[model samples]
Target: MSDTTSPARLVVLISGNGTNLQALLDACQDVSLAAQVVAVVSNRRDAYGLVRAQQAGVPTAYHPLKPYTDSGRTREDYDEDLAAIVSGFQPDLIVCAGWMQVLTPVFISRFADRLINLHPALPGLFPGTHAIERAFTAFQQGEIESSGAMVHFVVPAVDAGPVLDQIVVPILPHDQLDDFEERMHVHERILLVRAVQKWLTERASLPAV
Candidate 1:
């Protein structure tokens, strides 16, 4: 009665200090965790996650597929190569954490539903980058109560995927951007781990597709 007959394999893509990537590493230490990250890819040569990944004894690679002056490579072609690199790991789930590049349509279609992202906003609210700042601003404008985190399937649209899980963090009246971001990071890590666990459980209990 399981949707997936096999354990999910993860390939995490990061472009900065991968705080979330570290969380996933810690989560994998749990014997009950159903997913194992087999690879970590970054777009920056100096991303802190590369060092962390190296220390953790996980495989890591860099894919600088954009911002070229005259590499003469089209987006589709660049994505095709990137896909090949990620696919080399034969991953079941591809997680993007602070991966700043906008993936081309070809890249998205290549991975499709198997991709997931962790956003710092309550999603359906803040759609693109700088979500934490936007969330705090929204709170300041009396737009809402508590703002929080979300984990969803990655779609072509920014942060517009189906919700896998979410947690609402109480916004303290005197919170700053850094404070909110710290809290956001905590909830973001917790929510993503919980979501992955839930997704695995759901997959294991399904009658069929």
Candidate 2:
């Protein structure tokens, strides 16, 4: 935990559009929040989130897999290098928002308890990609009445981490996928910002590491 005089630093990772990242950036402006994003990292060079981070004056780094793979770097090696870049920031927390890669265990173990990820489904419902679509399909098939979003610790297993927070959104029978998706995105953004603030507050109450 950090002293009240110093804000907890954050390193955010993103793979695509960063609506969630933007939310955190906005939340940090409150001045009362106990955290600030120190850097943003992306695996894709063309990710628009880099632009968003730049606009917010946050330093950004790109670690695309193609270059490393082209040079015959193993997945574990790529993750290790990425971990080093993140460590250089010395962040108290690392957040993965829309980051698409299946990170190696090396990276997950490096951050451990301090790493968190945002997933577009309730815990244990959908674990991998296209969670929103899967939920919609289930709803259409009458398998569920609602779907949700969750934020959880990043563990060795994909999307199989200890859940920190979640919020449900009902799938009305008449709801269209596009509208439902937009609603989920909105809920995700709110939940992510609130969850990060709460997590930092809880950590701040603990004894220093």
What C-alpha lDDT do the candidate models reach, one value each?
0.84, 0.91
Candidate 1 local lDDT, 110-179, one digit each (tens)? 8877788888877688888898888888889999778898888887788888988899988898998788
Model 1: how far is 2 from its true place, Å? 14
Question: Tens digit of lDDT per residue, candidate 2, span 1-209?
Answer: 34655888989999999889999998887764667889999998999999999999999999989978898989999999999999999988999999999988989999889999999999999899999999999999989999999999998788999998999988887799998999999999999987898887778677765
Q: Estimate each model's TM-score.
A: 0.91, 0.96
Span of ten consecutive residues with least summed lDDT in model 1: 1-10
Error of 2 at 45 (Å): 1.2
Q: For model 2, what is the alpha-carbon lDDT of residue 40?
A: 99
Candidate 2's C-alpha runs over 4 A off are 1-4
TM-score of 1: 0.91
Clashing pairs in 1: none
- Output the number of the lDDT-best candidate: 2
Output the number of the TM-score-best candidate. Answer: 2
- What's the CA error at residue 83 for candidate 2, in Å? 0.5
For model 1, state the Cα shift of residue 186 in Å.
0.4
- lDDT value, candidate 2, whole model: 0.91
